[model samples]
Target: MAGGRQISENKKGLPRRWRFMHGAYFYSVPPGQECMWDGKKTFHLGRGLPEAFRKWAARMEQPGKIHTVSDLLERYLLEVIPKKAPKTQIENARHVRSLMAAFGSAHLYEIRPRDIYRYVDARSAKTAARREIEVLSHAFTKAIEWGLIDNHPFKGQIRLEGETPRDRYVEDWEVIEALSLSAPQKRGRRQGPAGLYQAEAPDRPFTWGYASPAAGCEFPGRWHSGAVS
Candidate 1:
């Protein structure tokens, strides 16, 4: 074998009659089989095993036939998925399904940023689309590390949209009104300043924002300055 070596056992515990390997390329054959090989002609182990195995091994030895997006995804599922967290594995599986549905048939080298952009545009949720691309990007990065692909399609090509922060301001009067309107029983056991502050604190300020009022109101009871409780 030009790019392969022989082994006594297959991936399973069962004994393999003949196994061959060469430079990341290998195939198994039944015991005492004679196949023609000159390191130039196509390798063939005569009929007995699945036809796909024969075809795949033959293609694996050829430089031009290597690295399909589908194959990379399959490898990622097998090698990478197990190491991920349970929630992450579920998420990645969903992303992988989408990726395969779109680009599984394409070769890894053939996929471009434009194809990815199209996929992103087709998605309804921008956040979800961004996550999907991120997952695919990670898979492509793994492919590059594994030497399956020379470059990543997403590298420096895709830009995710930024999320804006929200700021809300609540006036002290609104909080006081809400507290006054709430029933005495709903205000809990205490009728003191502590109880009113405690009852109002959870329901109001945080929902809106808590800032000192421009013009403060006088409290009916003793209350600390700048403190809700």
Candidate 2:
């Protein structure tokens, strides 16, 4: 369901009114509802509109006040949690990037489950979808506090399972393969992601961004430490 926000009025010089979609709602004040200036409105996008979004539409439309998603997040960051922790800020930045990177920076009022899923899927492999979506939910929670918007889209939604953290340790071959592709070095007889070895450049940072169980360069396996590639 796409929630489209609209400014309804016969205001002169207006570009026929603006319409924007979020999810499961189509907002628009039928012409003549404009009291002084064009007023914005939100409404259910489909028959099976979520109760939450329906309620949101009712409140926002009964007294039309539309805000963009980014606008809401900004208010949430500074105005709502002025004293937010440094770690939290960092996480927010990371998660927010995943969201925007998944979806373009459109009017925030237009995000939908589709966009949300896209975000989750895009970063699901790298970072668990649970934390990624959770962080986004926190942003919406803050928005609620600031009265910018209600209803966290992630609520009641299925998230990646929360089990004991899983390990994505790559194998010797896998590691060498990835490393070879990313940080290509003197390709030797070695193959797989394992051949991804760098000459002992104790001076250089670990050539690989993440670690694998290989060449002893990896944890517990660190063997010939003389800069095992």
Candidate 3:
């Protein structure tokens, strides 16, 4: 502070900036010695005046200027991915971990459109990869909302939409097959006995076989065959 005259307050009596930032909020240990909150915290400023403090702070305040892949990965998992189903979230977390293992230390700014495009292609080939891509896309979308990234790499990408077709639909031929009873013995309308079909007895399980086309079979033989009333 140099002990000079105290600067006057701003419009709201709050100084916009201070010379010596106070508070010893974090502790340090020897290198390679594990700290309880290592790799999961943001309190690493030390006693020396950093030459790149302004640049670093500016980047930190930037909407999505994460310096390492790990930072973005953690943020995406904790903030965005969990909003989906638990199964989906777990899968995305696994994919994100795999991606980081592949390139964890890479700087975020260093990742290019080509890199992301390659990622899309690679992740699109498998179910897990596709799900991971979806989650990654979601996180990137949020980053765009925060003014972090400019655009989504998965935009306009060709991928599966996860749908299964229904087989219940029957064509006209199928409906005819279902109602193929003979016309003479048909309980309902019969086309002059030509369309009449007789189902066999219940001797065998589901033994109701359709009558042969060449030689029509007897209908139960209990009364006049193929004769109504």
Candidate 4:
């Protein structure tokens, strides 16, 4: 019975200026008004009805409202986030939501570098704030790419709390303890590694553990020479 109705019939009960087509919601640009829609005839909203409405609101609302940071974030989440890896999609969603809470209502052009620095300072979790700012910065970059904004506010902001480098020399006992905790075990035809291979250098032997075995699990060099026999 649903197939018998005209294409227009299925769009009934939908919001004004919205259409359902090709199994997804779309928005019709007013006649002779393609300039307002970036020269597109019809915008493919999305498959999900609730999400379609959200995108519709972002597009159909007042012109000023469409240029808000929140609108940009919504568009990014709708258009960019889905193409990412599954774990990345989840993390980016969390970051975007946090950005929304901070700068959602602000107009895109009105956000400045100082405001971003202030947001960074206010956050107790500096690491999380850095990640959120990275997402926001990329959102702004995409907004510029989309012609929604002319500039990015905080792309190169300094992150004070970075990951600790593993340059410190790891003690032999530390490596032994780590190996004790999760050493490889013999399985069927394959045997567990006899020992890790260290390079010929004696002064920096432990650093190899932090990096990689010089010869791999087979230990064909200094490790067999007397290091781990």
lDDT of 4 at 217: 37
- Residue-by-residue lDDT tens digits, candidate 2, 135-173: 555656655555765554433333333335546543343
Per-residue lDDT for 103-145 in model 4, tens only?
7667776675545545655555767777677678677777767
The all-Cα superposition gives candidate 4 an RMSD in Å to the true structure of 23.3
In candidate 3, residue 59 scores what lDDT? 28
lDDT (10s digit) by residue, model 3, range 1-229: 6323221111111111212234211223234434433543333433222211322242233235565656676566545553545334434555766566534565544443333433433342445545455455455566566666675433333333342443455344224433443443343322223212222322211111123335543312111134343
What are the Cα lDDT values of the candidates?
Answer: 0.47, 0.38, 0.39, 0.56
Q: On lDDT, who's better, 1 or 4?
A: 4
Candidate that would win on TM-score: 4
Weakest ten-residue segment in model 3 by summed lDDT: 7-16
Give the lDDT of residue 23 in candidate 2.
Answer: 27
Better of 2 and 3 by lDDT: 3
lDDT of candidate 1 over 34-59, digit per residue (tens): 24243433344432223323444343
Residue runs of model 2 more than 4 Å from their true location after superposition: 1-66, 80-82, 162-229
Flag regions of model 4 displaced more than 4 Å: 1-65, 157-229
In model 1, which range of ten residues has the least summed lDDT? 6-15
Candidate 3 residue 59 Cα shift, in angstroms, is 24
Error of 4 at 199 (Å): 50
